[model samples]
Target: MSFRNLAAAFALTCVAVPALAQTPAPATTAHSASDMGLKMADTATVKLKFVTVKPADITSSKLIGTNVYNNNKETVGEIEDLVIENGKTVTGVIVSVGGFLGLGERYVVLDPSTISVSNKDNKWAAYVDTDKDTLNKAPTFDYSKKK
Candidate 1:
């Protein structure tokens, strides 16, 4: 296992979990460390189970415009659009952040893997893992492939 995975394993072990995490996380469908870093694999080697929370479940559901926060609770960007790659998995999230009132709304791509369902009170929130500057510095994508 790589250092990142080792650290994650250690961190997870350190946490007060009610149960132990299944070994190798049952072969996650999400991208592996190699894929996340190198963008090597475009398809999953395993099937993972997940439940998609509906739009109504999001706390910012009816807001029309809601901000996305990072793991540290810092505003990363506003979720203006969503993009899925390869006709299946959600790959990139188009965020419109910074600038004043749409004058300079930048289209930044937040990796889908970096996001998780923010378990808010009776609702869901999209939380990205990286901070604002790091988010802004991420690579841009050509989102012509609309799925």
Candidate 2:
């Protein structure tokens, strides 16, 4: 072949190689059953227990005992009582923050709206929306007639 033709072919091949290099490779398989076997997917099926309740629902519906914890998971308080409106609107929950063996525990009242309800797959946590000063000055409740 002529030198000019050979050189032209080489230049074309070089340009083609770079263009091909700039192209992305085809995608490979991204997921498999084993990779996500234990992960909770949006489409996964779950069986759950159900119940029905009315005004009495507020009393009959089973609720988890409130467990107040310190930053280190130390048990600081337990919900002794909750004050709810007649319509089941929880106004506030009394948290027993401190005491030695249930003796002189100081009850702290927090707004029920601060609590976050959680399930097995999810979690509920309380966010004290009130400022530190407000929470500190919240009225204490009498444990005798609490939640």
Candidate 3:
């Protein structure tokens, strides 16, 4: 009722008003199933059919040590490691090229689609369309630097 009291109350209200205004509003649904005419299922209940390869067809361990050859049937490199994307798809293969008995070896990354596999003389062989010289010229990949 007093002027001093009224002034004090007005100051307090001014400070309180901004804080209240700054408070975040409750989240609202941006989209609804009825709006799209499609019922949404829980992500946990959703089943995604991911692509898969048979274990008998090719195993990781078998591929690791497999020697890669060129069209000339000359050994170009050995598959040192496989680059997997999203922990499922095989994206690339790291081949150790231009080295003798693992000494001074340089690693080259090649896409999995670029390589082919064959069974000949009772042995499974991996082949690439590139030659040894071409693969040797590719930029080297350092496995030790991977984070």
Candidate 4:
């Protein structure tokens, strides 16, 4: 080869060698599954239970904002929310009483047993034994305090 070509090749090899050597290697982690925020469960020891939804079952979606009626079929209050205990049991049902377009509204928590929810012709209805006047006279639920 020519002298000029030989000197150029030598200069290129010297510059490329240092650049290739400076490249970083892939990193390895020593963390386990739990350390990496993954929950590891033993299938042999864990027992999984499943729930079956029947046609007669009433879901929370049908309860919320549903109008509650008295024994006379008069609208007493509207269900605003539900209070569940221990993440499974529903202990109370919050209903809004004496409200007009959501103004001057008062909330009352009633026992789940006092309210009977039924579904007929795809329409859900909630029935209570008390009248509208009695519900308005009942104790009001305060949002600020935890009870």
Highest lDDT scorer? 4
lDDT (0 to 1) per candidate? 0.50, 0.44, 0.62, 0.64
Off by over 4 Å in 3: 1-56, 145-147
Residues forming the 10-long window of minimal summed lDDT in candidate 1: 55-64
lDDT of model 1, residue 132:
72
Q: Mind giving the per-residue lDDT tens digits that candidate 1 earns over 1-96?
A: 444333332332322123433435335555443332112357864454333333433322321145788888877677655443432344556677
Candidate 3 total steric clashes: 0
User: Candidate 4, 83: how far from true, in Å?
Assistant: 0.5
Model 4 residue 31 lDDT score: 33
TM-score of every prediction relative to native = 0.46, 0.41, 0.59, 0.63
After the best TM-score superposition of candidate 1, give how far the Cα of residue 146 lies from its true spot, in angstroms.
Answer: 13
Where model 4 places Cα greater than 4 Å from the true spot, the runs are 1-48, 144-147
Residue-wise C-alpha lDDT for candidate 4, range 1-147, written one tens digit per residue:
543333333332222332333223237634332322112355443233223344544556677778899989998888877665433345678899997998888999999889888777878889999988889899999842232
Model 3: how far is 123 from its true place, Å?
A: 1.9
Cα RMSDs of all predictions? 11.8, 27.5, 24.1, 26.5
**Clashes per candidate (backbone, < 3 Å):** 0, 4, 0, 0
Candidate 3, residue 82: lDDT? 64
Q: Candidate 2: TM-score?
A: 0.41
